[model samples]
Target: MECWDAAVSSLSLALMVLAVAYLLRQTRTPTRYGRYVPADIRCCSARLGWLVQEVPSFLLPLMLLLLTEPDTEQPGRTRRGTGRKLLVWTFMLHYFHRGRPVPLIIVLSAAIFCSINGFLQGHHLLHCAQFKDTWLTDARLAAGFLVFVLGLTINIHSDHILRSLRKPGETVYRIPHGGMFEFVSGANFFGEIIEWCGYAVAVWSLPAFAFFFFTVCSIGPRAYQHHRDYQQRFEDYPRSRKALIPFIL
Candidate 1:
């Protein structure tokens, strides 16, 4: 294996291992954010916190693209390189759209996660991935892209359902209905998990796959917690619904 490949694979593997540890930790003690924020914890403006924590994931890839030049002397290699970079940038673009009151601890931890993931992904694109001209025509890529689009549609629709459950300035939580919510309490989480899984398939890179594993371990617990919380808080919550998946999880 090439040095970059070996390094990326090793790093990705390490991330996956850490993700397992994180999963165990989260299982024992759920993350303390959203509705579960601790009473005495420090807090930050959601807008500012989100911007700061999430920017690294966006900026690092951009810098990698701008500051580094491809092997332009080899025209085919240059095109492939640019393709990888574009895909990497696209992977992180969705993070630009979220903001709410967040715990300072959450912000700090998320910032670290974002920075590590941003560097791992961006650097992998810059140094490791190599695509041929026919990659665009691959059937698997097409299928993966379709899955990604589907997941994104589901995610967006589910978000709308959740948001609509509450009127403006309403602090009470209501059981979300419609869309994927009919089947899973964490329909939004389900969609996002599908989104990243599809992205992994599209890239067919170890780094991307590792990131998917990390995404699952990281957010999967949160989704289950959400499910349990809903069941406990609302006696009328749909009994048939699962946690992060439809019919199973």
Candidate 2:
């Protein structure tokens, strides 16, 4: 493993710890609403060990990336910290505001994955001068930056819309009417998928691709599940919208 990859692997451990801590804090809080997750959406605990196995998902890739050959370098290497910082802020705000455990853990997992992988990808530009002359690297980096920004923007905006839709005593769920919700039932999922996909392409590495594959496998079904649930729950739900994709399923 290169020094950079090794450092990221070590950082991954810290991230896993943070995820556990977030879950602990969320589980302890009683005032936090557990209403966001629908009963139907949750998998049975016996079948849902994957939720807690996110650490291994990340670690396994980190291990492989450590063992694999580095990707070829790209031109005009510039580290984009702006998107990363925005993600950090959004992640902190999500947990700080909601005592809920699930979203908190998801956010932590995403934060750690994006942040650590991003740092390593960006750091490569500083250390690998030969990679600075390739357009592929530049395009990948740009895509990754866009993914991070767009993903967080969609996530925060969608959550805000949903929260506003919540009435004090309401039990049943209502349709989220604004923003990307109009285009797809799972714009948040779409944003997240795009974010990781971009990251995978940017790094062009197995670890990044592993993360992307896991995300798509996990969240893609979720979007479909949410889409079906919304249609069943609301008669007036948008009929034109797909699950995760915009025009196509």
Instruction: State the weakest 10-residue window (summed lDDT) of model 2.
Output: 91-100
lDDT of 1 by residue, 112-144 (tens): 888888887877777667677767778877777
- Model 1 clash pairs are none
Total backbone clashes of candidate 2, pairs 3 or more residues apart or in separate chains: 5
lDDT of 2 by residue, 1-249 (tens): 344656644554554454455445544442111344544553223113333423333343344434445444345542223333332232222222221234444544554565564454333332321333344436666776577667766777876787777676666678888888889998877877776676555555544455466567656766776788788888889899998998898
Q: What is the lDDT of residue 209 in candidate 2?
A: 56
In order, candidate lDDTs are 0.81, 0.54
Give the top-scoring candidate (lDDT). 1
| lDDT of residue 34 for candidate 1 | 77
Clashes of each: 0, 5
Residue pairs clashing in model 2 are 73-131, 74-131, 74-134, 75-132, 75-134
